[model samples]
Target: MHKNVYTADNAAMLLIDHQVGTIGWTKSHDVEEIKKNAILLAKIATAVGMPLVLTSSMEDNAQGPLLLELDETAPEAFAARIKRAGIVNAMDDENFNSAVKATGRKKVVVAGITTEVCVVFPVLQLLDEGYEVQVVTDASASFTKIGDDAALRRIEQAGAVITSTSQIVSELAVDWTMPKGQALGKLLNLGA
Candidate 1:
């Protein structure tokens, strides 16, 4: 597989700060929709046997814990939830960065709450480190539509792929005959 392509062999999923407190404030997308997309992404990643990393910002305080659906859907064996002290950017936290590096995959499918901050910060850094990054736009949210739009623009300007959850799932599956493909299609209600 080409390094530039986000095949299952080369891509991993990174979720950040999808907590109740932050999600409740999201204005760019419907809160329920964000939760659904996040859960769907997690389920797809799990079904495809992809490496997954999760992180939360200030979960002990205002952020609350990761959404229960994600927590339950993400595979425990293939996923690691990094506990950061106070780093807003998961890439800055040693544990989170190490978890991502340990995945041995260069392309990351990333999503998070507050697209302008938690999601974009680490995405820019990951791009700087020469990793191919794709941001799952629907799986992430911002305080306002303007904030989400601007953040996506910044990420694209930095050379990251700005894509949607369904697009990523399709790219990973490639063919409906494959078991992962069938599973993903069902999860996304695509009826493949």
Candidate 2:
């Protein structure tokens, strides 16, 4: 497999700051729909045996905790929760950065709430560090449509591929005859 391509072996999934408080403020997409997408991504990643990282900004305070469905569906994948003290970006937190590095996969499929801040910050930094990053747009949102649009444009301009949840799952699965592909189809309700 090419190093730059996103395969099950080369890709990891990172979810950042998808908390109740933050999710409630998202105006770019329906919060319920985003939740479903996020959960589907988690399930698909877990089913495909992908390395995963889950993080929250200020779970102890106003930002609230990660959605329960993520934890329920992919408990093991929810391996790390970097509770940032004051860092606006999860990449700025040492533990989060270290967890990502430890995965050893250079292609990261990432999404987060409030696209401009939570998602973009670490993506740009990861791109600079030479990771092939793909941002799952539907799995993330912002306080407004404009903010979400601008953030996605900024991420694209910075050279990250903007993708959707199903696209990521298909890319990772490769073929329907494979076990991972079969599992993904079932998980997505596409019928095996």
Candidate 3:
């Protein structure tokens, strides 16, 4: 495995706070685009058998609820998702932090709604804990482009890898003939 790349074997996915209320306010990317990218990442995790952990915050209120499509896309992960009770930083929530730790994978592919807080907070903690963090920018968004860019810069400067859904797919699926590669290719309509 390449030292800098997170292949399927070395990585797990943490999809955070992609809730209806949060996504409805994101301005960094089109809502549909964010949904598409996030859903694809979830599918990739499932296809490659990568451990996945989903998280949400205060689903009963303004946070609304996690995207239902995510549950449909990766049902097993959805079943085990961490429903945080207003924890701004998911890592600060014991259950959420424990869930990620339980994956037993050192590299984490992360995406979330409202990049500045929901994504950046746990990401920083994950980095400090020695995990290789990959932030899928397109799949994560903020209330403004400036906020999103600032969050990306902060994580990048602190040793996290700033990435996109497509880059992640390519790295995890390094060979088109491999089962993971083939599954990802089919998802991307690349004629597996």
Candidate 4:
């Protein structure tokens, strides 16, 4: 079978603030479910060999520390790549965007906190630039369901694809015969 239009090799995973402080504001998705999906998103990249870029607003001297599980699922080397952008939408922030662009991959699998700014702005910008962006909706959220929906609508209008983390992982996996297929299945608790 042929590779998907934009294969994982051409893709990058950008997981935004899955921080402990921001979890409360994620009104679109259940807190427990969001954490599950976040870890699963991390596992997907590990399984599929996709490069992941994690970013947070401000960890040190900020509101609170990041989720411990976030660092556990994504180690120092992985988390070290995390951008310490003070801006909500790292993609809109010059330094953050430059750092992401430096990775040199066009396709992006993105998730973030508060869908309005953190998730929405970046997805639309990337889409406008002709980048194939998959916004992981379930893996992100906002202060309210209405806000999250609004963000989704804006990104869709801009021609970006809104999807769940699992959906993004499934699409990138493409088939059941991938090299790490079984492992991916296990991580997602598919019981394969």
Number of the top-ranking candidate, with TM-score as the measure: 3
- In order, what lDDT does every prediction score? 0.87, 0.88, 0.93, 0.74
Model 1: CA > 4 A from native: 1-3, 75-79
Estimate the overall C-alpha local distance difference test score of candidate 1: 0.87
lDDT, candidate 3, 81-177, per-residue tens: 8999888999999999899999999999999998998999999999999999999998999999999999999999999999889899999999989
TM-score of 2: 0.96
Can you write out model 1's per-residue Cα lDDT over 65-88, one digit (the tens) per residue? Answer: 788777678748324688677798
- For model 4, the run of ten residues with the poorest summed lDDT: 76-85
Error of 4 at 38 (Å): 1.3
**What's the distance in Å from true for residue 64, model 2?**
0.5
Off by over 4 Å in 3: none
141-171 in candidate 4: lDDT tens per residue?
Answer: 7888888898899888888787887677667
Work out the TM-score per prediction.
Answer: 0.95, 0.96, 0.98, 0.88
Alpha-carbon shift of residue 88 in model 2 (angstroms): 0.8
Give the Å error, residue 176, model 4: 2.1
Candidate 2 per-residue lDDT over residues 1-192, each given as its tens digit: 555568878889999888888999899999999999999988877888888899888787878888988889888766556677758888989999999999998889999998999999999999999998999999999999999999999989999999998888788777877788889889777786
lDDT of 2 at 137: 95
Ranked by TM-score, top first: 3, 2, 1, 4
> Which 10 residues in a row give candidate 1 its minimum summed lDDT?
74-83
Q: Please give me the total number of clashing residue pairs in predicted model 3.
A: 0
Best by lDDT: 3
